[model samples]
Target: MQSVERTFELLELMADSGGEVALSDLAEQSGLPLPTIHRIIRTLVNNGYARQQPSRRYALGPRLIRLGETASRALGSWARPYLAELTEITGESANMAVLDGEQIVYVAQAPSPHSMRMFTEVGRRVDAHATAVGKAVLATMPADEVAQLLARTPMSPKTENTITTIESMHEELERIRARGYSIDDGEQEVGVRCFAVAVPGAPAGAAISISGPEARMTRISTDEVIPLMQRLASSLSAELSASA
Candidate 1:
C-alpha cells in the first residue's frame, strides 16, 4: 500500500513537471529516499507507465496517453446527463470543457431546444481568452500562472467585446472570482451570451457553461441561471470525483 501511494505521488510529481523529471529532482520533490524512488520508478518503467528520456530524466510513457484519452472520453459521457439537465432548465445550449495546454476543449454539449441556438461541436478547441468556460477555468488558477499562460497565447479578438489585453483579462478574472461565475458578453460571437461556473472538485481546469442569444439570456434570467449552473457544476464535480 505504501509503495503504491509513493508510486502515484511520483507520477503526479512528474506530471506537474510537464511529464518529465530528473531522479534527483523527484527525490527532492517527493521527500523519498533514492532507493525507494528508484525502485518505484523502475517498476513504473517496466510496466510502461514511465520511460527514461535521452537526457536520462524520466517521463510519462506513451501507454498512459491511451489511458488518459479513454478516461477523458468516459468523463464526457458521465457528464452528459448533467449538461442535458442544464440545457433543459435554462433553455440554452450547455457545454463542458477542460483547459488543455493553451486552449479550452469542449468535451460534451447538450443543444438548446430553440429553433435558433448556439452550437459548438464536441472536441472543438478555442482560445481561453474568448469564452465563458475558458474564463471559468482560468479563474480557478493562480494569477501568476495565468499570466504566464496568457503571455504565450495571443488574445486575438473574436468579437469586439472579446478581452484583448492582459490587464483587462486580469480585472475580468477578479470579477469572476468575486461573482462565482463568468460571462461571455458577445465575446466569442455576436448576439450570443454565455454564463459559466467552474466545477469545484472536478479534475484539472473543468467548467460548465450555458449559451444562447443575448435577448433570451438576459440579466433578468441570470439570477435563476447562475445558481442552477452552480448546483449542476457541484453535482457534476461529485460524480467526477467518485469516478476518479
Candidate 2:
C-alpha cells in the first residue's frame, strides 16, 4: 500500500479502539514490525495526533477531536443548505442521511411546519430498511453490495409497513429506479410518509429525503414528488460535484 494509505490504516485502527492501542497489537493488526510501528506512532504523538497511555497503549490525542469536529462542521454546513431547500420546496420535513455501515446516520434535519410529524434526531442511527433516505442511497449501490448488507443485517420488520425480506427490498429498489425516487409509505413509523432521491456521487453512503404526515404527503404522489426530487438531486449533484 502507499505510505499515506498505510498511515491512515494505522490511524483508523487507533481510532476504532477509542484512541488507545497496544504497540504489539498495532503491529499485529497493521502487519508491520513493532519497531516500525513504534517509530510511526512516535511521529504521530509528536505531531499531537496521538498519544500513549500509562499502560503503554497509544490513543488518539486531543488534537484529533478538534480536527474531527472541524470536518463534521464543514460537512454539515455543506448539507444544511440542500436540506433547507428540500424542506422549503416540499413544505415538510427534510433530512440528509449518510450510511454508516448498515445503518443510516442523520447529519442534518428540518422539521415540518405542522405540529404532528415524525422527526428524526440529528446524529441518530436507524435501520436502513425503515427510512426513505436509506432506500434511495441503497439503490445507487451495485446489486452485490445491497445483497451483502441485507445478509449481514437481516431485515427486521420495523412496522407493519416495513419490508422484511431481501427479495422485497430488491423489488423496492427496482421500483425506486423505475420511478426515479423512493417512497417511505409509513414503513419506519406509522402515519408518516416520505419521498427520497439519491444524492449523486456521494461517497457511497448518502441520500436525501422529504417527509411529512401521511395526510399531507398523500397529496403529493409519486408523479409530483419524483420530478421535484429529481430536480433537487440534480442541483445537489452539481453542487457536490463542483465542490469535489
Candidate 3:
C-alpha cells in the first residue's frame, strides 16, 4: 500500500512539473530516495505508463491518455446531476469545466429550458482569460502559477469586454478572490453573461457556472445568484472530495 501510494505520488509530482521531470527532480520534489523513484519509474515505464524522453527526462506516456479520457467521462457523469440541479435553480445553462493545461475544457453541462439560452458543448475547450469558469479556476491558483499559465496562452479578445492584458487579468482575479466568485459580463460573447465559482477540494482545478442571455440574466439579482452558486459549488466540492 505504501509503495502504491509513493508510486502515485511520484506520478502526481511529475504531472505537477508539467508532465515531465528528471529522476533527481522527482526525488527532490517527492522527498523519496533516488533509488526508490528510479525503481518505481522503471516499473511505470515498463508498463507503458511513463516514457523516457530523448532528453532523458521522464514524461507521462501515451497509455495514460485512455485512462485520462475515461476519468474525464466519469467526472462528467458525476457532475451532471449537480449541474442539472443548478440549472433548475437558476433557470440558466449550467456548466462544469476543468483546467487542462492553459485551457478550460467543458466536461458537463445542463442546458436551460429557455428557447434562447446559452449552450456550450461538452468537451469544448476555450481560453481561460475569456470565460468565467476559467477565471474562477485561476483565482484558486497562486499568482505566480497563474502568471505562468497566462503567459503561455494568447489572451485574444473574444469580445470587446474580454480582458486582453495580464495586468487587467490580475485585477480581475483579485476581484474574483474578494467576491468569492467570478463573472463574465459578455466577455466571451456579446449578449451573454456567466457567473462561476471554483469547486473547493477538487482533485483538479475545477469550476461550475451558470450562463444565459444578458437581458434575462440581469433580471436576476447577483445577490441571489452568487450565494446559490456558492452553495451548489460547496456541495459539489464535498461530493468530489469524498469520492476522491
For lDDT, the strongest prediction is: 3
Return model 1's CA RMSD, one decimal. 3.2
Q: Candidate 1 residues 41-71, lDDT tens each?
A: 9989998999999999999988887876776
TM-score per prediction, in order, is 0.79, 0.74, 0.87
Question: What tens-digit string does per-residue lDDT give for candidate 2 at 181-240?
Answer: 888998988888888888888654678888888898889766776777677767777877
Instruction: Answer with 1 or 2, whichever has the higher lDDT.
Output: 1
* Model 2 misplaced regions, further than 4 Å: 6-72
Candidate number of the best TM-score: 3
lDDT (tens digit, per residue) of candidate 3 on 7-104: 99988887767788899999887889999999999999999999999999999988997887787788888889989998998899999999876788
* Worst 10 contiguous positions by lDDT, candidate 3: 11-20
Q: Which 10 successive residues of model 2 have the least lDDT summed?
A: 68-77
lDDT of 2 at 135: 94
Better of 1 and 2 by TM-score: 1
Clashes of each: 0, 2, 0
Give all candidates' CA lDDT scores: 0.89, 0.80, 0.91
Error of 2 at 14 (Å): 13
